[model samples]
Target: MWYFLMSDAFTFGAFLISYGTIRFSVNHWADPNQVFNAFPFAGHANLPLAFVSLMTFILIFSSVTMVLAVHEGHKMNRKGVEKYMILTIIGGLAFLGCQAWEWTHMITGDHTVLVDGVLQTMGTTVTNNPWGVAADPGAITAALQKTPDANLAAIVHSLGHGGTADAHATLGRDQMISTIQAANLHVTTPGPIAFGGYFFGITGFHGFHVFSGVVINVIMYLKTKFGHFDQRGHYEMIEKAGLYWHFVDLVWVFVFLCFYLV
Candidate 1:
């Protein structure tokens, strides 16, 4: 049971990660600021919904508290166990609120913006659009097949033949953005199937983790409220909860690094 549930979760998160990678590889992709944001007043500020980043650190620290909780629970120090466990639940809840607010903002597309006498996109969907002299996915697939070693030269030739799919020419880059805008909502963006597939696929997977952890922590919180954990022996339940929480935070570290840092 654990294997199946966890394997599915892990696979989904990893796939979404790969999807994000392929999306960014597009020529002069959109920035995250224009794509997503915090609540109204905070939006004017340059904050990155960075609460999520702080949550990651809080979760890691909570794991340390969990270790203390477990140690105290084993020694039958009911007060210490309760104290740390309650604190851990609060941390998890704070993280959940951050994620919920983030989603509330993310699902809505970024409205169009006019800049420098040209339209430039800001949302993730921009990465998915394809318009104007679009590259043939089938041909791109064939090129991938034709490549000798998946090296730069082979890929460059593939893109060049298809008219600069890779980033290089500045004017062409602008045109491609305009093209994707024109192609917006009508066709999938250029490149292989993996490109569009991964964009939505990977992040959805990670979001699922955050969701599940919230549910589990809520359950733990209830049991604590009912005194289900105290005087009942070890707090392995909380320990296991902490393990999953830490794993979620650790993955976000990578997600933030790979998706945003670049």
Candidate 2:
């Protein structure tokens, strides 16, 4: 397990290094603060890195529980092992749930952008970036003139001016356009395509490791519950699993630093 983990660390290190290289080479990379400034159930409130911080806390806490489980295993305390393992599994699942919501939010989010003197809505994806540099005032004004009534209304609603979607949809086009022009609204011109690529790739890889760790913890929990480790006169299996779980947690710290913090 140690050898495997060391090799895995090398792989992750290479990915992060490459990501940094490309990020620095780019003239304009998306701002992490703006990109991650979102919280679940908080409409339009800018909370930078808040959700990811919660995920980091949960993973670190799970690592602590894993350590406790390992210590319990040393004393042949089956009940303690079961309890900590369950906690670890729950933490892993919670992290996965948070990640799922973040992914959905990013992919399905509606971002207004100026393209060819026309305003269009798009979301972040491997080939598209909606978090680019701010569009020029001239370009924005031109696009607004060419924007459809419904699109204009959507933009007004996104800025928190037109009420609920249902109510916002009933608003007149002239009123929607007037609301948008009165507000300090800014649209983007599309950022580097590699931004979304690396984001999904590296984060997805880390999430996979987290999911695998959760599965291993579940198996370990079952083994403890069934007396498998106790019958063997030792719980070395739990210790090995602990090594992997800890490694996963450590990798996340770097992942969070690379993708979210730095």
Candidate 2 ranges with C-alpha deviation above 4 Å: 161-170
- As a TM-score, model 1 comes out at 0.55
**Per-residue lDDT of 1-262 in model 1, one digit per residue for the tens?**
4465477557756665565666667564434443333454464345754654565676677666767766776676667776877776676676666656565554342332222222322233424322222334454333333322313222232222344323433334334333433433222232233432443445556667767876786676577657777747656687677667667766767666655455
The C-alpha local distance difference test score for the whole of candidate 1 amounts to: 0.52
> Candidate 1 at residue 4, lDDT?
50
Clashing pairs in 2: none
Q: Which candidate is the best by TM-score?
A: 2
**TM-score of every candidate:** 0.55, 0.93
- The prediction achieving the highest lDDT against the true structure is 2
Q: Find the 10 residues in a row with the least total lDDT in model 2.
A: 160-169
Error in Å for residue 203 of model 2: 0.6
